[model samples]
Target: MSDVDAVRLDLNNPVFQRDLHGLQKVERHAALDTLAKLRQPNWQQVYRDKGLHWEKIVSIKPPPGIAALCSVRITQTRRAVAYRDGAFIRLLAIPSDHDATYGKK
Candidate 1:
């Protein structure tokens, strides 16, 4: 196992805070569980399973001056959007709906 401590979460983002606050109890728990897995060194393997449904978000361009973004399954109906900031996974949002999480199509 790699160093699990390397993963970092960005809790300061207001949008991420708002999205997390909006989740129901069960959804919040699920999201937390996903976050825990992401912190693990074997996250890549964990996300390979269909249940996680991890993938990069290409349709919706990231905000100006930002690099690429990605999304990972938080629950059946929710996703956690984030971007790679060096070794950290800076979670930006946790939209409950799929379309809203990805943006307008």
Candidate 2:
């Protein structure tokens, strides 16, 4: 919605998608609310490195010729969202294990 290229979901990472999708059942407004707050002017600065884990939500893009991978960092509880870029994409959830070594809090 911020016009920053559509949010990419990596299907290869089923864990991440499953987690994010689960959130929808609990509170559809949760992630959307959090993301909306982060979309304000200078929002990046506010959420730059404010995620719960030892890691932060990284801003990424695919390099030339190479396909991108899904990567998500739960800004609230250190959850992960797995996804890739391109039409007819494969988006899925990535389990926390994949990110265990990255941002450990």
Candidate 3:
């Protein structure tokens, strides 16, 4: 639906919504703030943001229908897993720890 290449976030996934709500208020806010910042950049900028740490999940096989699974820092200490669907970053999870984000499942 987007003509521009700017990054867009898809937080509508049921698991994503659940995981986000599971965070403590402060952490949730931090994640939201990070999401806001993320939406401001194009994919190239996001890939270059050291703090975002955008990386492909090589440790786990991506589910069918997705090109690749990726993780990005959503808060100071939390990383969320997602896959790019067009211009949208479809966030799928906010793991409890860093390793869980891309660790073997």
Candidate 4:
């Protein structure tokens, strides 16, 4: 697929950077591997990939300029909070707890 059609990974958010950098060595390695795989697919392919388990996060409010929050299984035991901005999948947070990813108590 062309660059326009391929899914882009955005890791510039401070929350994402801090959370990712705080991960254990193994989880960090897995997350990076998954992110690499994410860059290889088109948007449609990513949506259809059951392994990613892409879903909308309706339990919490999104930030300003963000339309909606979404989550993807970034590792075997971790999910990340993110949103789509054009062709970019801009990751916002990777909370330690699975439910926290949805911003739940």
Best by TM-score: 4
Q: How do the predictions measure up, each by TM-score?
A: 0.80, 0.34, 0.91, 0.93
RMSD of each: 2.5, 7.1, 2.1, 1.1
Reference-based lDDT, each prediction: 0.76, 0.40, 0.89, 0.91
Error in Å for residue 69 of model 1: 1.2
* TM-score between model 4 and native: 0.93
By summed lDDT, which 10 consecutive residues of candidate 3 come out lowest? 1-10
Cα-based lDDT at residue 35, candidate 2: 43
lDDT of 3 at 102: 75
Q: Lowest-scoring 10 consecutive residues by lDDT in candidate 2?
A: 82-91
Q: 44-102 in candidate 4: lDDT tens per residue?
A: 88888898998999998888899999999999999999899999999988999998988
Ranking by TM-score: 4, 3, 1, 2
Q: Candidate 4: lDDT over CA atoms?
A: 0.91
What shift in Å separates residue 79 of candidate 3 from its native position after superposition? Answer: 0.4
Residue 4 displacement (Å), model 3: 2.5
| Per-residue alpha-carbon lDDT of candidate 2 for residues 23-81, written as tens digits (9 for 90 to 100) | 64434355555445433343234335354221323444433654554333444444444
Tens-digit lDDT track of model 3 for 1-105 = 245777888899898899999999999999999889888557888889898889999988888999999998999889999999888899999999788897854
For model 2, the local distance difference test gives 0.40
